[model samples]
Every structure is written in structure tokens, then in C-alpha cells.
Target: MEENIRRNKIVGSRRFSNYFWTIFLFIGGFSFLLAGLSTYLKINLLPFANPTQLAFIPQGLVMIFYGTLSLSFSIYILLTLFWDIGSGYNEYNKLENLVKIVRKGFPGKNREILLTYPLNSIKSIGIKISEGLNPKRIVYLCLKDERKIPLTPVQQPNSISILEEEASDLAKFLDLKLENL
Candidate 1:
């Protein structure tokens, strides 16, 4: 039972992340560009008209404050984008690590199992689709619970059967009574 078996092989979508960063870059770049254009044209685009006359502070100070705030927000979003870019997608390995199988009663049941893994302990989790171009989805396998003998990814379309197999196997392995949903 301890023989290593690599099972989960689901990959997450990077397109969504890419699109998010692209949008942020456009917005941030435009913001800075507009700020530069405003300075070059000597146009006060502040929300309030004649801000210099309304505020006791100098116009330059107000521009500095607004520019700094916008740039800071942009910087933060860009930093997250870069981090995601650096940590590329990875394949899930279920063989070497312990795995857990959870069964919840029909929707709205309060039953659940709480399991924790070291911050980076999990290799990855698997997300399965029903068929080519189908919207149906399911979480195929959870990488660590220290109870069940991790099941291999089901090549078939039925996820419920796979879940049942994993849960029963896990219950026997842990010697605990787990009711199936």
C-alpha cells in the first residue's frame, strides 16, 4: 500500500492570470501616462476645478499626493502579477504525499473534515472537467489527509464513483467510521 503512485495530474488555467495582469498593466500604464500628459500640458485634471484656489496647500503638493497614491496601488498589483509569473504552474503528485478524502452530505449538511498541511506541503490539487469543452467540474483529489490510500485519477467521466472509492479506502486506512454523503 505504501508503494509510490503518482495520481492527480490536473493543471490550473494560466490564461485567467495572464488576462488579469494584462488589464492591470494597461490601467497602471495609462494612469502614469495621463499624469505625465497633465504635467506636460499644464492641465489640472483634479476632480475639483481650480484646486489651487480651493485648497490652502500648493497645487504641486496635491498632485504629488495623488500621483503617489495611484503609483503605490499600481506597484502592489504589479508585484503580485510578477510573483505569479515567477511561480509557474506545477503538476500534482499524489504518490509520495499522504492524501485525504472528504464526503459531505447533500448540500447544506454541516458535516465536514478539517485537515491542514504545511504551508507548501501539498504538491497540488486536481480539478477535473466533464468532457471536452464542457463546463461541468469537480475536485478530483485532495493531496493530503494522512488517512486514505490516494486513488489514481479516473480516466472515466464519473467523479462520484471515484470519490466513493477514495472515501471508503481512506476510512479503512484510518480505522474511522466515515459516513458517505
Candidate 2:
């Protein structure tokens, strides 16, 4: 039917892993910062450790530097999580004979990214799988103009079968071929 439409929602930085990292970084950084301050002031700022015995020149300064770096990284992650960046949906509308890909970006004029193309322009659905240190499983929409738009989120890697099934399902819905790359 020409009125048929399909939509798939994608998750973003609001996942459990992101939350865990944010909390971990914040706690670790705060601890280091307190320890460094305790050494400089000759006082026990951290309840767990007596950093007043540590030297203020190198050890305390190094701790402060590392703490700053960790806090900055955690803040960046927190902002992304708050914004729910990269969260969006893919819509295949048979009625309009079009496909729409939408995603959220950083706070700016181009925060919301929306890409639309004719449904017929979809050449195939592609699945890419890689293992080892940095494992990745991703699904991509291959277009006629040689553009490959990734559909899957960059979180935990999905199983091979799951990736294959998702790609096949999308390919069938779009009436396009499925390619395993």
C-alpha cells in the first residue's frame, strides 16, 4: 500500500554506560581535586586520605592537572547526555515516496539535522561488522548517489545475527538489496 510507513527510533548518549562513565569521572575527579587541595593547604580535604603528607610541588600539582582533565571530560559527557545528542529517528514513507533521517546535534542553529531523499534512491541496506579491540556493528543505508548513511547508534556492539536481521528487515521494507560489508 502506498500509505504504509515505517519509523525506527535511535538511542543516543542517554544510555546506562554514559551515565556510569559520567558518575565515575565526577567522583574520581572530585576525589583527586580534594586530595591535591589538601596537600597544598596542609589539611585533610578528603575524608579517606591524608594528602597533607604529599609534596605540593609535583604530586599535588599533577593530581590537580589530572583532576581538571577528568572534570572537563565529565562535563562534556554530561552536556551531551542532557541534550540527548544523536537521538533521532529514521522514517520511510511510502505514501510520500520519500525517506527521512533525523538526528539531534549540539546546541546551535543546526542542532536538528534532517536529511530527506526519494525512497527509490536507496540502493541497499549495508551491515558492517568488526571484531577485536574496538568492536563495531553498524547498519548503513546505501544511497544511489554513493552516500552511506549510518543508521545504528555507536554504543555497545550488537550481535552478528541481530545486525543481520535488522539490516535484512530494513532492506525488505525498502525493497532494496542487503549487503554485508
The candidate that achieves the highest lDDT relative to the unseen native structure: 2
Give the lowest summed-lDDT range of ten residues in model 1: 84-93
lDDT assessment of candidate 2: 0.90
lDDT of every model, 2 decimals: 0.41, 0.90
- For model 2, give the RMSD to the true fold: 1.4
TM-score for candidate 1: 0.31
Per-residue lDDT tens digits for candidate 2, residues 35-153, read 88888999999877799999988999999988988898899999999999999999989889888989999999999999998988888998888899999899998988988989998
Best by TM-score: 2
Clashes of 1: 1
The regions of model 1 sitting more than 4 angstroms off are 1-63, 85-181
Q: Give me the runs in candidate 2 sitting further than 4 Å from their true place.
A: 1-3
TM-score for each candidate, following the candidate numbering: 0.31, 0.96
